[model samples]
Target: MEMRAKKSSRSSTSNTSGSTTTTAVERKEIERRRRQQMKSLCAKLASLIPKEHYSSKDAMTQLGSLDEAATYIKRLKERVEELRHKSASARLLAAGSGTRRGGGGGGASTSSAATTTASGGAGSSEEAGRREDDMPPAVVEVRQHNDGSSLDVVLISSAARPFKLHEVVTVLEEEGAETVNANLSVAGTKIFYTIHCKVRTYVR
Candidate 1:
């Protein structure tokens, strides 16, 4: 970074004078500017120091008198603030036009999509999760043999819910669940089955 700064400054102030080297006056001015730049850089670095740092009283006593340290710190802080003010003023001066990002200085930049999206607010993610939970459990299939029987009855009946084995079996029977075959399972939940129902069907 220092090399880049030096190179830029050197290029900005070319030393050429009828093919001769830089004059003493120009060289002196450059050195003076360099010192000023270094002082400004030091001020910026000093501002980053945390305020109100603590040290053990015994350690501080061993190091130096608190009064002297405080004086030094106050000077550093004042210098940093002065430079920050200067930088802020320069920025304000350079900002001739209105604020960009398609927004006025005090106004927010909002897209049409963002304005229309009241549905997906703070509760949207939770609502989506709840919708997933509310989805109906899949209808288990139960195929029947020549003799009327189905796995559907056994499956729903075993569930520890409003539906039980006997209750579900009754439902399937009422629904004309016939040509019943066995059910399938995974770990615990009854997942799949194959059953042929009567021609007419109605949801309970």
Candidate 2:
């Protein structure tokens, strides 16, 4: 009876030991797989960033790629915001111009009609004036901000004319203005140009 009991006890101990060993091996394998997954993710992140942001030393670490990716994302966000602002400004200016042209047309027609009632001579003069106002060669308007730190140049020109944009840019460059952003749009036979410039740049 004593020998049978001892054998039973020994078998139980061996079984417990085997179970512990198997559990340890399984845990170790899981940890190794986790590390491999982390390394693969890091490599993928590094690949997404520009090569200029990475160097020989940056590739060796686990967190280096993450940092570079974060910085690149930040710059992209800033660029997007800048473009949004420029687009908004362009739209506002265009809208304002359209409103002015509409209002001017309304006023001019009323005034011309009143003048037409005065005399035959006045009617002929009104026709001449209408022709002159209908087709202006070009109009350039420079508007400076109240703070004097920046300015916007608006140019409206006939598409058929020889008004080159580069000439305006050259003039701005010579006048100590740094061109920040520019937009061009065409409407019918006319071209609209809006250039934003910095006022406090190097003057030479």
Candidate 3:
């Protein structure tokens, strides 16, 4: 009986030792896997950062620590935001400049057209009388289709109190032209009118 009891105790001790060894091995494996995952994540982060942010020596050495990498990433984000703001501001300035240039050109063209119309056939005296009467002359351009069935008209004039659009419509109706589409815009004191019409031709 004593011998049997001793044998049983020895077996129990052996089992306990084996369990301890297995646990130790498991812990070591877990630690190794954790280290491998950390290295992989660091490599991915380093790839995202631009080379210019780091010194030439540091680029070759790679980022020394996680803290340094994080700081560099923060700086890169700030720089990108600054560049985006500058780009947006540049676009807005360009758009404003274009608008001003277009407005100036429109004013210049209106002045030139008025001068030409006044000097062309009215003579200096009649032009002076028209100016004295404060009657702003209208500029009209007409284009007819080859079939004489359609016309496109553009009218540019000053915005008088009564507005001459009604008279223009009435005249078009009397000339056997039916208005199809019209677009009107006012820039400063000048009014731009575009009209499309269909006209009937009477065959004699």
Candidate 4:
């Protein structure tokens, strides 16, 4: 009976040892797999970052440290934002320049037109003096689009005499322009006229 009891105890001890060994091996395998999965995720993250943002000489070196990879990603985001801001500012500046050019062109045209009218209407030396005193200085500007599809004209003058707006419209129509819109405003002694028109490319 004593020998049987000792054999049974020995067998129990052997079984427990074998079970402990198996459990230890399984735990080790699980830990190894977890580490491999983490490494794969880090590699994927590093690949997504731009090469310019990497601080290391070799891009692969950045993947070795999680903190470095994260820093590169942050820098990439900031660079994108800075580029976006610069693009927006450039567009705004271009728009402002276009507006100013349109306004200046209109003013120049109006002034030229007024000068030509004044010169041609002066038939006699005595009449020239009277006409000059009666007619306010006029400015007219015509701006054509790059496509040659449309034009905008602006006229500004001091109301010295009865300045006819219809005469200007008639001249535009004769020049093969279809009036789209016309605006006229009188402020004190000043007259402002803005006309939007489409130019006819072919005679129809």
Tens-place lDDT per residue, model 1, 1-204, is 999999988876664652345466778899999988766655554444443543434323313334435656777866764554344333322221122222342224244444556766425645644764554443332323343232222232112121222334344454444333434354453333323333233479
The digit string of per-residue lDDT tens for model 4 on 132-193 reads 56755566666667665787877776654323556666666766678899998989988788
- What is the C-alpha lDDT profile of model 3 across 1-204, one tens digit per residue? 999999999999999999999999999999999988887887777777676666445553334545557778778766764554344334433433343335536646755666777555347546644663674555566666766567776776655422345556666665566889888999877778887888755689
Clashing pairs in 2: none
- Model 3 spans > 4 angstroms off: 47-52, 55-63, 103-204
Model 2 TM-score, 2 decimals: 0.50
Best by TM-score: 2
**Per-model TM-score on C-alpha atoms:** 0.19, 0.50, 0.44, 0.40
The CA lDDT of each predicted structure is: 0.42, 0.71, 0.64, 0.66
Q: Look at candidate 2 and tell me the lDDT of residue 65.
A: 78
| Model 4: ten consecutive residues of lowest lDDT | 88-97
Question: How many residue-pair clashes does candidate 1 contain?
Answer: 14
Ranking by lDDT: 2, 4, 3, 1
Q: Kindly provide the TM-score of model 3 when superposed on the true structure, using C-alpha atoms.
A: 0.44
**Residue-level error in angstroms, candidate 3, position 118:** 6.9
Error of 4 at 35 (Å): 2.5
